[model samples]
Target chain A: MLERVDKAKKQIHNTVDALGRSVNIMEVCGTHTVAIFRSGIRSALPESVKLLSGPGCPVCVTDQGYIDTVMDLAAREDCLIATYGDMIRVPGKNGSLETMNRSNVHVVLSSDDAVQLACAHPDKTVVFVAVGFETTTPATAVAVMTAEKMDLSNFCILSAHKLVVPAMQALLSDTKNKIDAFLCPGHVSVIIGSDAYRPVVEQFSRPCVVAGFEPVQVMEGIAEICRQLADESPQVKSLYSAVVTAQGNTRAWELIEAYFEPYDGPWRGLGCIPNGTLRLKRQYKRFDALVRFGIEEIPKEEPNGCLCGQVLCGLINPPQCGLFDAVCTPDTPVGPCMVSSEGACSAWYKYGRRGKVHHD
Target chain B: MCLAVPARIVELMDDRGVADAMGNRWSVRTTLLPDVQVGDIVLIHAGFAIATVDEEEARKTWELFAEIAEFQERQAPSSKEEGTV
Candidate 1:
């Protein structure tokens, strides 16, 4: 594995040297961010070539208002919050779900577990906290479908979902950050395919490489992007060809379409993007917490000194935040970026931010 | 923010399939792939089979994973000669 990574590193170096220009590529997946750091790939690269992390972490990009809203729901006695392990410790306006120490809020691995929770507790409203890119929405959809099928009326979902394309467009439109090309999320690409990213490449004329999570996969993707830049060709290519196709996963898209509709959604740092979020369709609105419980959207405020928004958008690194390390360690994370395991801030704090280990 | 993967369908129901991903088994719907069946590896996202994957590609990925394991094994220096070296 090290040998392959070494070769890939050499290839990336050679490609970047040949390009002879500063290529500031942004990886739009949290897993890629962690993997890149874990593999020590950042240290292996030429100083001229910089890899930035985009708004790929679902939790990090999720708005503060939504976190406060979710925390509000968690405070209810008749409600049970079921969520993936990542969101438990994320700080809300007042406090986090983990801080409350309420027995009702449970960490579940999948949406199916939430469905089972609703089934087991027929009296209580079992609300599954749904958050993720396309990879996680289907599980929540399945849970909803299962609830409807089994006539489990108490089951609902608080969707904190965001789409990839609009976020990409938002990044491109931002004057604060200059994203040369995009190393797209591999897992997300499997569902949406390389074609979903065609618009970005065509409109922005920036290279898009849908890449896998492994270190070598990222290095190969970087090499591909460098090759495209060197040749002045900006196109969408699937470095993880084994999983991603041109059209992406049609069945999953259909299922999501059946259960949810495109609506204006909130992003933590980017604010609201039209049709950038998925909400339960009217047919399944009964299973939507926002609609079922009449939880009006509240304008929530972020922490005073948190740079999580800019951090998520690749506009700034974690160290730029004033509260980093001192007040934003994983144990006492002040922002969602510090809370979620896949978050860029968390990854840097855990794996990357240490003694300078520069490599040739 | 999309995360999807290809998994082989191990069980088929009316419109859903039980698929496996990296040893994790999941109940996924086949609404996207109308003609999906057991033994077929399907691309899944958000708990639905989005498309029927090319088996050739899936096999090649498994082959690569195997090669990775083999390479890791070969790269490991023998413990017997470790101290001497």
Candidate 2:
């Protein structure tokens, strides 16, 4: 095991030395951002290999419009807002779900809990703010199925689910982007499959390596990318192959396809990506909270002096933002980045480091 | 928010099961992985068993960090049957 770690480190260093240039590797998963920082992998790696955090954090990339919509729903008397703990603190246009001071809002751990909450309270409409990538979408599918099977009347989902592939493509499509390779989100790939990355790898000419959350796994993924760069033959590969198969979880995907359809919607930082947001399918529109509440997702501008948009693009660190620690503390977050526990600003604020953030 | 961990299924009831993730036990839906059984080790993500964890791949993780052997050893207790496991 130690040999494997040493081998990965040596390979990474060799690639950097041979290139004689700084390698910009982006990890497109929020979990990876936290894992890399928590494991101290940033300091362990070569100074030339700058790890850039991409727009992977679901809460952070959740368009301001969606946050505003969720907050609007939270204020309603007829609806009860059920959401993951992270979304409670995220800042919308008016006020956050936590700060709204509403008794109807409930922070649930699992999607199942949202369903259970709906069943328990039959009078109020239980609107679950479903926001996440492919990894967490299946649970929402299951919850929806559960609601349908039980014939629950007061249940619907406000899906802010976005595709990781489209977000990655959007990053590379930009002329100013300088990312060399990608450390793909491991868990999202578990559902979307490794083959899903084939388009980005082939089209963008960047190597994409699927990685696990472990320190060794993350390092191994970086090493694989480094090896690809050294050879000048970039390809899509998976270091975490034990669970992430070529086809991924077909049944899980089937579940997602059964209910949701992809749409090109506005992301917080990156504008409207091609097929970014996943909304409820036509047949399943009855269960869509947006449709039920007559809410429209009008993209809102980020607050003045907030650099969250730039931070998500890997353009600047959190400290570069004027409101970073001074105005935007985690306790009183100005942006979703500082609000989400896995967000880049929260990671930077907590760890006090430079150059890190990512996807699912 | 995509944080998931490998958990050993202690009991399988109809569609849902009670799985133990490093001593933390909770009810998980087996709707995703219908083939999952009571003894199967699965990745518990957002109250659903998303994938069946390959014990070999999981053991490698614990080998690097001994603190997590509790989750690994439960599936493969005896070192003699490591190959079969």
Candidate 3:
């Protein structure tokens, strides 16, 4: 594995040198962000090859108002919150779900558990905090389908679910950040397919390479991007074909189409993006938590001095934020970036703090 | 938030199946890939088998990595119209 990693590294350097210019490649998967840092690839790369982390972490990009709203739901006596573990520690306007220390809130591993909670408890309204990209969206859809099949009216989803392609499109259309190419999410590609990124590659003229989580896979993915730039060809290439395909999982997409619709969604720093958010379709509105509880999703600004938005856009690193380490450690994170394990800020805190980047 | 792992199916009944990743075991819904069998390996994401992994394709991907270097040396970038490394 080490030998193969070294071979890919040499190829990356050769390609970059041939191009005779520096390039910024963004890995648009939170898992890929952590993998890059953990594999020691960030520090091992040459100074000219800059790697930037994009808005791939669902927890990090979730709107602040949504956090406050979930906290509000947690405070209600008739409500029980079933959420993925990443969300419990994220701070909101008043406090976090974890700090409340209430028995009403429970961390669940899957949407299946959330539905089961609604079944087990006949009275309390069980609201699942659903947040993720396309890879996990179908799971929540399956949960909703199950609820409807079982005729369970007590279960609903407070969906902060986001789509990956639109977010990337929003980033490229904006002029501030300069990204040469993309290391697309492997699992996301498995669900959405490699062909989903064709618009980005064709419209924006950026190469998109899908990669797995291993060290060799990551290094080879970067090398592929560099080769594309050097060769002056931007195409959609799927390196992880064991699961990903040109068309992707059709059945999974069918489930998504049946349950959700596109709308303008709120993002922390990026603001509201058109067709960026997914909500339960009109037919499935009966299971919509926001509608059932009469909750409104008002946009809220980032906490005073939090740079999560800037970090999401690849404008700055986590350390560049004023509150990154001193005030926003994982134990007492001021922002979602530090709290989620797959977040870039959390990755830097755990593994990439000492790595040298192009900035250095 | 999208975390998925490859696990082999140990048991199957209709859409529901038990998947084993190494020593750990859990029930997974194979509704996406309804054709998946008890012994086939599939990628499990959030209690569902999203896609079946072809072990042959996985081995081929790594083998292609070795050809990447040769592909770089063989083809001249300016002359070619298309083909991935």
Candidate 4:
């Protein structure tokens, strides 16, 4: 195993040395960002091949209005708010779930926990604050399926899931970040398939490598992209071939299709991308939070002078925003970027961004 | 961030499986793996089994982590080597 690590590290070093010019490699997965930082891989790489973070954090990309709506539901008397731990601290217009911790909102590690909460409290309405990319959507689907299967009307989902491919397209369109290649989100590819990125590769002429969350897998993915870029060949590749397939998991897709449909959703920093978000399908409208709670029009609200939107779209770096370190620390977060642990800004601030060369 | 981990299915309930990941009991939907059994190892993400994992591969990966820990232990100061995991 040590021999394998040595070989891979030597290969990486060789690749970095061979590619004399500066190469910008962007990892478009939040988990990858954490792994990269945790493994201290960035320090191992040469300054020539720079690795940058992208809009891969599900909770970070959730718009302010969506958080406000969830808060609105949390304030209700008959409602019990259920959500992933990451979304709990995200500040809405009034207060965050952390502030409402003593009030009603309950943070659960999994969506099944929310389903159990609904089952246990049949008298109360359990609003599972569903927020994630495709990786986390299946759990919400299972929860919805469970509610339907057991004929439990007490459970509902407030979905804020954003699709990966559309978001990737938006990133490519941006002029600020000239990403040479992309390390695509692994979990999304597990459901959508490695070939799901074929369109982006064909159209934008960028190499997309679908990789697992393992440190080795991530490094290998970067290596794969460098190999493609250095040779001037761009294509969709799978470094995590053990898990990800060309067509992906069919049944997971079926479950997702059965539950939700793509819709225009407002990303916290990326504005609204057409069909970039997932909403509960009409057939399961009874489980839809907006319809069931009759809370449709959430007045749009942006943070005061926060460039979370631009940060999310990769148009600007985190520190470029005046409010980043001074006004928007983790404890007193003003935007979703500062709130989510996987967020690029949160990653930068949490892990030292002192010497990072801010692009654009 | 793409956070995924390998887990062994402890129990199967229709399309759902109760899997254990790093000592955590996760109620995972295993619809992705049609042939997955109670003892089968699977890669899970967002409460769903995204792929069937090869136990041999998992053991190899764990062995790698264990090896790294051992090496790091040996590299630690003489007094701290005894305290290595």
Candidate 5:
């Protein structure tokens, strides 16, 4: 395995050298960002090749308004708010769900847990803060289906789910960041399939490779991207064939479509993207927490000195921000990027790369 | 937020099942891929089995690595010969 990794590294180096120019590849998955940092793959790459973290972390990309809305829901005396663990720390305009001292806020492992909480509390309305990409949308769909099957009317979801491909298009359309290719999210590809990126490759003429979370898989995916650039042929490839197929999981997609529909939603760094957000379908409207509680979304601004927007765009690294290490450590994260474990800032801080100089 | 893992289904009770990966067991629902049975490896995320692993394609990916190794071997001797010349 070590020999194969060395060969892949050599191939990447050769391909980059042949190109004779900088090849910037953006990884659109937070798990990939952490895996790359933890495996020290960034340092091992050729200087001509650069890896940038994109808007893949769902929590980091979630708009400040969304957080404030969730916090407001948590504040209601009759409402029970259940969310994933990472979301509890994301700062809103007033404070985070954790710091607000709200006893109704519960950290759940899955949407199923939230459904169970609703079943247990028959009187109080349980609102599950659903947030993730296509990879996690199926689970939310299943949770919604389970709630319907069990006739749990008190259970509802505040959907903050975002689509991956639309956001990729948003990034590519931005002239400021010059991304040569993309490292597609592995788990998302399992649901949407490798062919889902066909539009991305066709429209933008950028190579997209669906990669696994393993170190060698990531290196191989990069090597493949470099090879594509060297050949001047932009295409979609899947290196994670063990789990991902050309068509992906059709049942999961069908379930998601049945329960949710695309809507223009706001992102933290990237503003409202066309068809970037997912909302409950008409049939599932009763389970919509936003409608049930009459919660209105209040526009909120990102905290001062938080460069999470620029960092998400790959325009700057975490250390480039003055607040990164000095005031924005993981223990007390002022920004959403530092709060989520999968966020680029959190990964950089945990891997001891906070003070070092990074690429532009 | 999109972290998922491949785990082998150790036990199945109707639609709900338990999968084991590296000694840890998780309760995963196989409703998405209901055809999955015990001993089959499935890609699990957020307490659900999203897809089954394609063993054939996985083998093909491994073969591609072997081909990469063979290509590297072929290129090494020619580059060395060029240096000597």
Candidate 6:
């Protein structure tokens, strides 16, 4: 295994040297960001090749308005909020769910746990704060289906599910961020498949390689991207083919299509992206929490001096932010990037990257 | 937060099943991959089986790695200590 990794490393260096120019590769997944840092891949890489973090963390990309809306729902007398642990510390307009001192909000591990919580509390309206990429959409879909099977009318979901491909498109269209290639999220590809990235590559003319979280797999993916760049051919390749297929899980696609439809949604750093959001279908309107509670969209207020927006766009690293370590530590995060474990800032903080110089 | 891991399905009951990974078990839903069965290794995310791991492909990847190691060994026959390679 180490021998193959050595070969891949050599190939990467040779390819980068052959290009004789700076190559910017953006890994659009928080997990990949953590893996790259954890494996010390950056230090091993040549100076010409750079890796940047993109808008992949669901908690980090969740708009402030959505967080405020969740806080509003939690404040209701008859409403109970169930969400993943990472969201508890993300600040809304007034405060976070943890600092709100509200007993109605509960941290859940899985969407099914939220369903079970709803089932237990038959009188109170339970709203599951669903947020993730395609990897987690199926779990939310299954939870909604389970709620329907058990006739749990009190249960509903406040979905902040964002599509990956649209966000990639948004990044490519922005002239400020020059991403030469992409290291696509492996788990998202497992559900959406490698073929889903073909459109992005075709339109933007950038190489996209689906990679696993392991160090070798990540190196191999980077090597493949470098190889494509050397040949001046931009294409979509899947190095994590052990699990990902061309069509992906057909049943997952069916379930997602059945319950949700594409809508324009807001991202924290990036503004409203057209058809980048997912909302419950008309038939499943009862399970939609936004409609059930009649919650209006609140105006978003960006955090003061927090460069998480810039960090998420691959324009800057976490250390580049003034408040990154001083005020935005994991314990007291001023931005969503420091709140979520998968977030780039949080990973950098936890993995001891504060004082070190970044390649970017 | 797309962090998924490989887990083996220990039990299957309709669309819901129990998947065990490294001594910890989770109640995972198999609705995404309805064709999955017991004892199958699946890639699970957020308490759901997203896809089944192809053992053959996994083996092939490992075999490629082994082939690379063998080629390196053939090139450096004098240094047969196996620590440097």
Q: What is the lDDT for A208 in model 5?
A: 98
Candidate 5, pairs of clashing residues = none
Model 1: DockQ against the native?
Answer: 0.20
Model 4 C-alpha lDDT versus the unseen true structure: 0.77
Proportion of native contacts kept per candidate: 0.36, 0.59, 0.56, 0.55, 0.59, 0.64
What are the TM-scores, per candidate, against the unseen true structure?
0.85, 0.91, 0.92, 0.88, 0.91, 0.91
For each candidate, what is the lDDT?
A: 0.79, 0.83, 0.85, 0.77, 0.84, 0.84
Alpha-carbon runs more than 4 Å astray in model 4: A1-20, A299-301, A353-360, B22-27, B60-85
Q: lDDT by residue for model 3 over A7-111, one digit each (tens)?
A: 989999898888889989999888888778765788777778888888888899999999999999999999999998888888988778988999999888778
Write model 1 residue lDDT over A86-195, tens digit each, in one string.
Answer: 78788887688878899999887667778889889988999899988887776677788888989899999999877899889878887887788999998788778899
Lowest-lDDT window of 10 residues in candidate 5 chain A?
A351-360
Best by lDDT: 3
CAPRI tier for the interface of model 6? acceptable
lDDT of 3 at A112: 87
Give the C-alpha miss distance for residue A114 in model 5, angstroms: 1.0
RMSD values for the candidates in order, in angstroms, are 6.3, 6.6, 8.4, 5.0, 9.1, 7.8
Error of 6 at A327 (Å): 1.4
RMSD of 1: 6.3
For model 3, the superposed segments whose C-alpha errors exceed 4 Å read A355-360, B55-85
Candidate 4 positional error at A105, Å:
1.4
lDDT measured at residue A248 in model 3 versus the true structure, 0 to 100: 92
Q: Taking the tens digit of each residue's C-alpha lDDT, what string does model 4 give over A1-360?
A: 456555666776776678777778888887677567656677666667767777888877887888889888888889999877777877887788778765567877677889999999998899998888877787788889889999999999988888899988878887776788899987788778999999999989999998776677777787788888878899999987777789988887888898999988888667788799999998999999899988874536577898887776655678888998898987678887777767777766755463444344
- DockQ of all predictions against the true structure, Cα-based: 0.20, 0.29, 0.24, 0.32, 0.24, 0.28
Per-residue lDDT over B12-71 for candidate 3, one digit per residue giving the tens place of the 0 to 100 score: 999888998656798888878878999998888878888887766534444544454364
TM-score for the A chain of candidate 5: 0.97
Candidate no. 4 TM-score: 0.88
10 residues in a row with least lDDT, candidate 6 chain A: A351-360
Give the clash count for model 6. 0
